[model samples]
Target: MSVTSRTRFVNPRLGTYFGIFVSSLLGLLMLLLIFEELGTAEPLLRWAMLLGPIILYAAIGLSAPTREPIEFFAAGRRVPAGYTGLGIGVAAMGATGIVAITGVFFLIGYDALCLMIGGLAGFVIMTVMLAPFFRKFGSFTVPSYLGRRFESRPVRLLAAGLMAVPALLMLAAELRVGAAAGGWLTGEGQGVVILLMVATFVVTAVLGGMRSLTWAGSAEAIAAVLALLVPVTIVAVMVTNFPLPQLTNGPLLRALMHSEAAQGLPIIDAPALQFALPGEGMAHIAKRFTAPFGAIGPMAFVVTILTVLTGVAASPWLIPRVTMTPGVYETRKSLGWATVYFGLIMLTCAAVAVYMRDFVMDIVKAGVPSSLPEWMQRLVDLGFVAIDSAAPLNYLSFAFDRDSVLLSLPVAAGLPAVFLYFAAAGIVAAALVGVSATASAIGNVIAEDVVNGFSWEPLPRDGRLHVARIAMAGIAVAGGAVALVAPTDPLRLLLWSLALAGSTFFPVLVLSIWWKRMNDFGAIAGMASGFAVAVLTILAGEANILGIDGALASILGLPAGTLGAVLASIATPQPSRSVLELVREIRIPGGEVIYDREMRLLRLKSRERSS
Candidate 1:
């Protein structure tokens, strides 16, 4: 546990670095705001906000090159719990989680809480059931762990293949988000900006791998959180004379309820928590801020939350983060920190939704059609919101695209242009962290578990590093193409990705760690069946061809995977004695990683053979 000369802990000046970064960022933003006040050309300011932070991120990436495998693959396993936790939180939220969730809350009111609740539950499961054990096992990737556990290269390769889709989907979603933010800021097309974003992801990921991502991601976390909080706080202070948006939103909720009632939107005596589809009977009329389940049904709510929980718990990218920490104890503490930061993020999101709803309701009550707010016009020009008609504007007349609403919120709040620019930078930061993290995971998995697993001989150190960098760039390119071609919103793409993750990895991961009876046959059968079911059901759900929907895909996918794994294990021979012993060792705490030791021995044997 003690720090030694050989240990590669993060620089102790990390705090100092972060402190300086934040100050410079905010100072630059304020300068831009003053320029606006002094009547500088608007186009120049827009371009600066769009490109400034990206430049900073690239600079960080350029500084992160490393020749060592451990440094590139695992950040040298010396990241403190707090920093690791921040990285986890940022990676989990990405641009989709932070932006889409808030926008969904704005659109659906209380029903959006399900996503937050499910994610928090997933973190708890990770802390209690998964992360500590993974840290003890010390694999570079999830597929690496599975390969080692089953002692089968085929199992490892299959896992790498199965996991690639979810990772790519997530990468696509993040790229789309960053592209949208950049498009909005620069008045450019998404296709063009997405290409730019892809290059940025590749540069950052290929240079330092996890070592760069871990540290830069921590910095992005700080910027994203501050960007989310500052505008919301300013808006809160203006309306309620309170700076704490998380706590002072009660009055706004009451105001929203009154506005809905006065607009004759309909009111019902049904319990606020009752489940009802959008515009359904009693619950349908329950559009008040405290009301729940109005936007989605009971089944949909349950499925959505469960899908998110399982997806997050077994996220391919997030799980490997446990290995970046110092030990099992630090892994546990890191997850705990992730929970705290994630909760703060979701709470702040809710506050954004409430304040946003309050603003729209006031406009509706004003009953001004021709004099619609300049902010709404800005949104319309930007294509984020559209007015339904030339008649008096009501809440229903304004349609907000959920994927882009977080970027629009500053406009909706009548904040100065600089605030809008600052929000854009924050979204860019969120999307970058997500892009780098997912690309890193996919690249490492492809190189280590798939390519290396297929090799007749282990690759040399330098060869491995080169392959990894090339793999990362290639993955980034594929992800960018998907982002450009897919018509789905970032949220929908994100949900599908989560459903796939939950279906394929969640069951096998849990069983492999906790069930000694699990073998290669079970692992293969479970992954194949679960993945097949998830894809078919997700497509069917998207097409409405069957009773299934995307939200419920995992409801069937997870059970299918679990059943396949359990049944296949029962029908097959038991695992060998060595594999069983490895399982037992992973369960215990405070020991060297068995996988690391085996890898070293295997390398020594290879060297002897070559000589």
Candidate 2:
């Protein structure tokens, strides 16, 4: 596909332009509000930060006249391989993983880093092994693929519910982060920030639908990369001045030197690096060089594999990318680009954490005000400060305090214009990308999965579009409500979402794709079992259930559910031959027909065969 073809098709309507213009103006106004409230040195810097992404989104909305709004949701089978790949990479490496994961690395040390590397490796494996198959299958949504594969509406509905739950949770977390950032910038309550953020998603989705989201998402992804990179580069330059090499030479040697200097009483022959400062500790050094495992552990490893596989195998978002592109080869090429970009973006997140650790620490030392919002003060008190450590960093701890840390860092840095600009942009990009993707996810489920499940009839294209917009608004409103009542600990909510996905959907998705023996009975049982285990584990406060942490629990939980389902299926009668055939067809390569077309064809052929 040509580059121009991949770009958004414009809507000539003045109202659309007006909507875009209004949104941009509101964003500018919000930025100014935040700057004034925060008493930051670079208040005007907020305008560029807010205006850039808003303008970009508006431009996308303006393109709606030429392009169908559904394209924003699914890219209408027209996206080029390169753009699709980039979009996928950006979409996956969203605020949840990039910002949240970095905070985890900073807190835990090298162990967390190791875990992250393990997770990435799992993604790589999925890319080579599972992504190809998913690309070949060419279904828009996972549930659509499931419905086709099983020839059971119940299965599709069930899968949709599963997918929707996690997606919503993720959306909420994204909003929480965005609102917190806005509050910090504006010194307004988090409530106001949340309302604005949620409103953005509603208006954009309502106006341009998927077409707008896709173009906006792509543009936001680019902005995100720059936003994350600028501040990281700045901090990296600053940290290079520290005596890093000397700190990591040898713990024993350092201890002896310290003892000789008689600065303080040495506690241990070689103190664990976790006890020292960012640049001075062995733990900090380990974190920079190693990967650590905290909550994700082996379970995380399995979940990561599952997430990537399912993402490729059955995700609606990816399906549209395949169809939108002109051809299969182009789609594959796009996937390749996406993989590289995803890896690069994830790595950049780690680098940013390393550079920002000291900056965070400085903020904590500055002391939080009692009058500040509870979330902000908690972040400071909880030591949201990242410490340079040799051990894999614990991102979870920092994640727990992310809202506060992100808000105060600029101020701690004396509100440098450049840093604030980058931070603000990153916050907005992360929120917009996250909310938009979520809105798309919810819309896909409702339009293609839930609506079709009731009867094998596809909703009219326009009706489907209408339902999607409604779903988007509903989701945003729900997320805003959750943010209103959510815990101050941002990381806790994030971990809960990850853990839920890892334990429930992660296991079921992996087994369903890889194991042919996984019947519907097995799938149902497995999903239920995995979800139960995850919820129970969280309630019980057990970090490692059955000696599995991180992504491993999901891997383990899959077996538990799969075994139950397998046993049940074995005891029951087998599904009909038609059902089996449907499964095979759904899994086959180049099954490019839309849900409605495919269903009609299947019924017609079935009647003919019977006759």
In terms of lDDT, which candidate is strongest?
A: 1
Q: Whole-model Cα lDDT per candidate?
A: 0.82, 0.55
**Model 2 ranges off by over 4 Å:** 1-42, 65-73, 235-331, 356-415, 510-517, 542-556, 582-611
Q: What are the RMSDs of all candidates, in order?
A: 3.4, 8.6
In candidate 1, stretches whose alpha carbon ends up further than 4 angstroms from where it belongs are: 1-8, 266-286, 388-393, 455-458
Model 2, global lDDT: 0.55
- Tens-digit per-residue lDDT, 1-611, candidate 1: 98464235557887787788888788879989999999989889988887777777777777888888888999888888898998788788588888888777777778788889988999999998889999999989998899889988888899999999988899998998888888878889998888888877777777788888777777777788888889989988888898999899987788787787677664334333233323201111235566655656666778878898999999999999989888888899999999998888899898988887887787787777877778878887877776777567666777776666666767887888889888887887888888877988999988898788864234788998899999989988989998888877677778888889999999999999999999999999999888999999888877877755665679789999999999999999999999999999999977787656766887989889989
Kindly provide the TM-score of model 2 when superposed on the true structure, using C-alpha atoms: 0.72
The total number of steric clashes, by the backbone 3 Å criterion, in model 1 comes to 0
Model 2 residue 230 CA deviation (Å) reads 1.5
